[model samples]
Target: MGIRHSSAGKMIWLLALASLIHVSSLEAATAETVKQKPPRLNIVFIFVDDQGYYDLGCYGATEVETPRIDTLAQNGVRFTDYYAAAPICSPSRTGLLTGCYPRRTGNEVWVHRPDSGTGIPPSQTTLAELFKSEGYATACIGKWHLGFSEPYLPANQGFDHYFGILHNLDSYEVAHFEDQGGVPLLRNGEVVDRNVDPGKLIKLYTEEAIGWIEERVASRHETGSSEPFFLYLPHTMLHEPLGVSPKFDGSSNWGLYGDVIQELDFYTGRLVDALERLGIADETLVMYVSDNGRGPGRNQQQPIRGSKLTTFEGGLRVPCIAYGPGIREGHESTVVAHAMDWYPTLASLAGISIPKELVLDGRDLSALLLGETDTIPEFNQKVSLNAEVPLRREFHQDLEWERIFTRQEYLNAFFYHGSHGALAAVRSGKWKLALNPSLTLYDLEKDPGESHPLNSWEIKTKLRGMAIRFQREMIEQGNSN
Candidate 1:
């Protein structure tokens, strides 16, 4: 009887030892997995106004210093061929928020009135809404040009808080409105009693943003649940009738425009530093991009010829920088992308699903950001509108509508023919044809600056066909209807 008892005790001891070993191995594995996982990234979108490709220090700009923006590029991916859906403000901003083409959304022009239905349609879902649904807090500060109505403001468009101008401004130094009807700043929906001073608009935006961040962090700490936040900071910097803060006046070697750019850089530095100080630097994503190109007319002070109205490269290609966790640093992406992409990209970052109805013109660049997209997809794009033909012999000719019959017709005749009425373009591979019943073909690979035209009938016809197909698609997709 004693021998049998001893044998059973020995077996029990062996099983107990195995269980202890298993628990230790499981704990070690759990610790290893936690260490390997990347931190959750918070997003901060810093959008500047009328900034150009050569506007930043990293993009070959020698005129003004953009050291802070440069540091962002050093730590993140810089897009070389990034584009805005439109070459203007209101429309492009609409595209950025909704991830849909502005033309499709019926916001093909700028909105200048408070009652104008020119803002983002209430029916449409914005990035903020999508993020908010998934437990992220969102705020939009500076330049809400969509519409000034209660239903059209930032809060209604998915933002928890909105602060900024109601429309485009000719002078950033003047009052936005004559009375209470057009207060420049608001929280949620009520206008702040202290009107936003035009000269200090940039500083105000930065200060408000920092405040928002601190509030969010505190709220998370109190709730014991950290809900990530999205900060959309769009500044009216480098825009015409330039307004500079008193400290930045005469601070730049380049005049008013230069001074404004310097001011922009300074504020951008402050925003980034605030995040770092709050201990959210590595987890926060900072994206610096321009809404569109500069003015179409020639800059008497600079080398570029064109201002906000022209269809040239100077009026289309803008500056864009994306920086954050897990992103490849200092790498440049040549992928043809637009502002509309931000919607889906931000959605993906927040682990939210984009709406099915919101057809996006731009793709999620996550692969590009993670160093996975080696081969870029061909960008076959076109900008189409009814153009007025110039009288063969006169400059002040009557306006007449000519339906650009085919892409071939448009490209064979109209690229770079920016007269007055309308213009369109078709870019495929290295060939880009900007047309308006006047053919202007450009090999972007060779002439990245669009300084010379190829002037070949074969290339023109091929691109024109591509443009026609694009136009047809646009109409069929209900984008032009």
Candidate 2:
């Protein structure tokens, strides 16, 4: 909620100052008083593949140095309790792009494979489409993994330009090579590289992203337009077939995976440098988050339990950092925010209204991001804002924030779904109820590992009821499949 400074607006001031500098002080004052439309913020979201919560230095990483990403975190709002939409790739991406739970979109359960006939339904509105509708230039670079077919491709999903592989890099390995050809690098759905080397993917995707950004800036200058842009750069590394550029091979003390992580840090720096080079750093809002959490290989995801594919804290919670103009620097927020919330938060930032037909599980987080609110609304409420003309809430509980956000996620009952799309747990505030094992409850604040159990029949019954109500609502909407 600070100053929305656009590069174009800054340029306008510079030119105005150049002409008015020779004039009297009164005339020069006009340059400062001039009114110009601040360009809508350009968005560059760098979504990682299988990064653990403690994978980056900012998140307590030690084996691998992630200076670039760490710096971004140091100078931005780092969310300690940030959660991805799902524990796996496709469902996670689906939740992020569509602003709905993967189940709501019927894309939950598993990653979309090459043979999967369907993808994100055309009826669903993606983040790209939402930004594009507001006239922002949209592009999707790096791993797509949504679908390889026509209607499901990035081009049809509202990205003006699409680059990189349509699916995962694992398909190109020796085991699956016979059935699935090497992941072909594509440009607007046309194969550019027949066999994309996973080792060079970081550099290639980095170059593509930087070049595309440079082109967009050049186009803006040439066309004399201030159209903002959106770039979804989902890197392909840190998942499987760990890749690294030649320069970074064996660069870390942690071996191949560390090398890959270092390479990622380097390329991420390149992207940030490109933005600064084009004088659009302040005009851009950059976000770094993982699509899902990984096993506690080198970095234990510390304090969190379980790993990817499971419905544990480690599987859901991951590192998230937001930087750029209008955001407070060097802030670590304990407030719980999920990937799904980005959809509505970005809409509010860009000043666009969602189409009324859509039903989003994500709440608008503009207030939280702007430091206006510390806690989210009730479980049933859709956003951080008061709904009615005055305000109205349907929940019966302690709604006051009390300047504490450690238990914010519990305010909104979060149901955890495993990789296979089975309901495993329900979390409300500080307590979590694991469904399958006779409805055992755990105080997550004290036991993030989900180790200790509290034998309380009342709490368990209430949590179980919450789960039942959630499923009922989901089925009522016909999205419980």
Model 2 whole-model lDDT (C-alpha atoms): 0.75
Extract clashing residue pairs from model 2: 410-429
Candidate 2: residue 349 Cα off by (Å): 1.2
lDDT of each: 0.64, 0.75
- Could you give the C-alpha RMSD of every candidate to the true structure, in order shown? 13.9, 7.2
Return the TM-score for each candidate structure: 0.79, 0.85
lDDT of 1: 0.64
Q: What is candidate 1's TM-score against the reference?
A: 0.79
lDDT of 1 by residue, 1-481 (tens): 0101123332332232222222333244554443433324578999888887677778766668878888888767788777676677777788788776676566766533555755777877887887887778899998887876667878888888887766556644235465554455666666674444556888888999999999988887898777888899888676654688889889766787878888888888888888767766656778999987874323333333344556666766678888765456678787666677677565544445455445555555554564545434112111000011011111111122133243223222222212222336766656778775587888876676667878788777776665555455456666333
Model 2 worst lDDT run, 10 consecutive residues: 386-395
Tens digit per residue, CA lDDT, model 2, 1-481: 1223464544553343223221233244554454543556789999999988888889887888998888887776899878888899998999899988788788887888877778899989999998998899999998888876789989999999988877776733333445446556789867787666789988888898889989988998999989889999998888887877789988888888889989998888888888877878866888999999886534334667678988888898899998776565678887657888888777655656666666777766655655545666332223322111111112223333222222333336667778888778887767889998687899977887777889997778778766765575667677322
